[model samples]
Target: MNFDLTEERQMLQDTLRRYLRDKYTTSVRNEIIDSDTGLSDSIWAELAELGVLGALFTEEQGGFGGAGFDIAVVFEELGRAGVVEPVLDSVLMGGRLLAAAGKSDMVEEVIAGALHLAVAHGEPGGRYDLDHVHTQADGDTLTGRKAVVMNAEAADHLIVSARDGDAIGLYLVAQGAPGLTIQGYPLLAGGRAAEVTLDKTPATPLGLTLADYEAVNTLALVAISAEALGAMETATALTKDYLMTRKQFGRPIGTFQALAHRMSDLLIELEQVRSAVINAAGNLEAHDRDLHLSATKNLIGRAGRLVAEEAIQMHGGIAMTQEYELAHIAKRIIMADHRFGDTDYHLERFIALSAA
Candidate 1:
């Protein structure tokens, strides 16, 4: 099978890579991470202007490219640059959910970067179950707590999941709605998330169901796995460069057979992750997408941890310093496993799906 990117995808990849390389340096990223908001408004706006946000949707949804490959191309670049923007929260999760709910207006705003949105589905102790929703909606009001809501502090509106009778429903709650409270905190991977509290908060019910959330959640899994691949790419590259340059006992440490073997192992692991991501991305619309996605995420979780740890160890103390690129890259790689689901979670899911 042909694995090469099409002309459009290749162009998109090249354009995004060049733009990020020129603008998103390690120093600039560090400042963004240290900032109170944990993101850059100017950079976010620029990315929108460059059509990065639009790439994640389809022409029917007011975007030119919404295919699986499009998401892979965009997020991989973002991860490689260690961008701290809330693209994953604002565009992939919130924007896609809005699109699924037929909320074209809100999706348009999201694509234009005029409105930021966060998905408030994860409740305390829910772990990674998409069907596990404890937040209840009584009429047009919601009362529940959402845990670790990414980009909640910056969101103009939140897409919250709530129990409505026997079904899980999606609700749109405006920021600062009555009885709504958001306690924002910086994430380890250079973005802001919040623990959101709602007490009889007014909300607008969306025309979406549990299935919609599950589909979007699966897409999110594919997106982040691709992001992990990009991060691993950067981390391993950084480690390879360090090994070749940093000398030990009058010779480059990488010249040692032991270190060379270790680096080769990392490269092999990275390629394995790359293959898994590709498989997941290609099968996004397949009937057996869950199996591939679960398998991909499981591999990413294990391989990402391996890549992050090995990269840091090979680089020594300097790799842990915040100023170094690998420090943040390593953090991004490790933290990615926790999103959607971790290694063990996906592994079990894959096994269950396979058995059925």
Candidate 2:
């Protein structure tokens, strides 16, 4: 099996990389992070126009690319830039769920960037379980609290998970609906998420099952694992550059034998992360997708922490400064581990699946 990117994917990667490099400078990203909404509307609109949003869906869902590689390619670029936009929330989670539920109209709007959506599935104590929905749907109304809903403030609609009888169901709740309240706050990395409170809010039931949610959640795992890989790459590169330029006692610190050896170790670990991401992306649609994704995420969680901590240690106090690029990059790398599942969580899941 050849590991090379196909012509189309290579072009996509190059185009996205160039665009982000030109437009998403560290200063500009800091401004976006400091803004009221914790995101840049102009940048989001431009990304939509560039077909970045469309790339996450299939042709049938009004996108040219929706394959696993497509998601990996796009998100990796986003992560490398340390972009704070909620593309993963809006497009991958919300839009893909909508598409799977036959909500073509909503999916088209999302692809066009006209409709911002968020998936409100996680609860206060749910951890990372997709089926641990305590939100109850009484007929067409839902009443429960959704914790840490990303992009909830900017969303036009929310895709909520609720318990309907003995099965878990998805419900669509319009933004500003009666009995809905959202308290927004900034995330540690960048961007904003909200604590959503629903008190018997009217919602439209979506025709989707728990299994569908699981599949999309797995896709999200693939996306963030790839994102972590890009972040690790950037962190490693930044650290390498710092070591080569920052002098210590009239010599470049990179020339120190100990530091050089540590950098070498980081590079080896980064390559391991890359391999895991590749395996996860390749097995996205396979029968054993869950097994592979669990392994990939577990590896990502451990390796990402190592890269972040090592990068910070290698760079010294300067790495923690808010103005410095590595500060945010390291945060992203560490936070990616917490998104889908942590190292311990995925390790147990991988072991369980292996036994099965």
Candidate 3:
């Protein structure tokens, strides 16, 4: 399928790019990063005003009637601007999870820009296996722990993945639920994460079938792969700009054939990953999803790593400093590598799938 974006998609991308550049500043991101909330209310207000927070949902649910690609576009712009808000966890993951679970009552709250959402699915022991879950939910009560829960403090709701009578499922838990405790854990990329402990926390089952679970989880992975595209593009752009201005050997470094070729190779790899992302998103109901998603996630992880490393190299010592956002951008992608899924483990599964 052609990945050419439609006119609406183009418009949304352009609008978000402009908005991020104008409104979201390094200082603003720093403010949120330094605060307890780990979120900039003003920036979120701006996002809501720009319709970015609700850019990729249905009109009936107060969304902008956008697609996954549209959300990808917004993420790219945010990545370039070094947005600190948890757009992926709050809007994309949360919105999709709710919609998939047949929860429309929160749609207006979400779209009206009132509620932010997060997912607590990764356990401390690890979800790399994806099936060896240890969390438990019984009769509207849950008891478990999830780590690396992004934007947990800011989220109004959380979609907790847990096991119920030997069946892995999702639960929608109110942030204020009685037995739930959240402790902050910030990342190197200037965002607030947390370790969430649910001690018999109140929750409502998502009522998902086996097929639904598989599809939603795979789509979420693919969706995150799409977000990785954003960070990769920004890192590439930063590298390109750095090479353009920074002098080396008394000349613009980018003019050097060796560095130019390296940038070209990075660009090619990024394009290949982009193709893989598109293919993965399209192969939703294909016979072998584990293979498709694993390959896609692996490619995205590699592409993200390559772009970030090369960008840092091009930026020299300044890349690691707080002055430039490239370092933080790289860090976010690197950490994002472990979220939703891990590349090496998934690649092993992909190989196992292909072997059969």
Clashing pairs in 2: none
Write candidate 3's Cα lDDT for 1-356 as tens digits: 56787887788888888887777776667777889878887778778887886776767556875454655566667766777788777876677677777678776677667888988877777766556567898889999889889989888888888888878888888888999999987778777889999999989888863445455566567667776777788888888988989897899899999999999988998898788877776676678767888898888788788888888887789989875777777887786677767778778878999999
Give the top-scoring candidate (lDDT).
2
Model 2 regions more than 4 Å off: none
TM-score of decoy 2:
0.98
- Tell me how candidate 2 scores on lDDT: 0.92
lDDT of 1 at 106: 82
What do the candidate models score in CA lDDT, each in turn?
0.91, 0.92, 0.78
lDDT of 2 by residue, 1-356 (tens): 89899898898899889999999999999999888788888888889888899999989998999988899999999999999999998889999999999999989888888899989989999898887888899998999999999999989999999998899989999999999999999999999999999999999999888887887898899899999999999999999999999998999999999999999999999999888988988998899988999999999999999999999999999999999999999999999999989999999999999999
The number of clashing residue pairs in model 2 is: 0
Off by over 4 Å in 3: 59-66, 209-213, 285-290
The estimated TM-scores of all candidates read 0.98, 0.98, 0.90
Candidate 1, lDDT over the whole model? 0.91
Number of clashes found in candidate 1? 0
lDDT preference between candidates 1 and 3, better one: 1
Give the Cα-based TM-score of candidate 1 against the true structure: 0.98
Superposed on all Cα atoms, model 1 deviates from the true structure by an RMSD in Å of 0.9
Candidate 3 accuracy as TM-score:
0.90
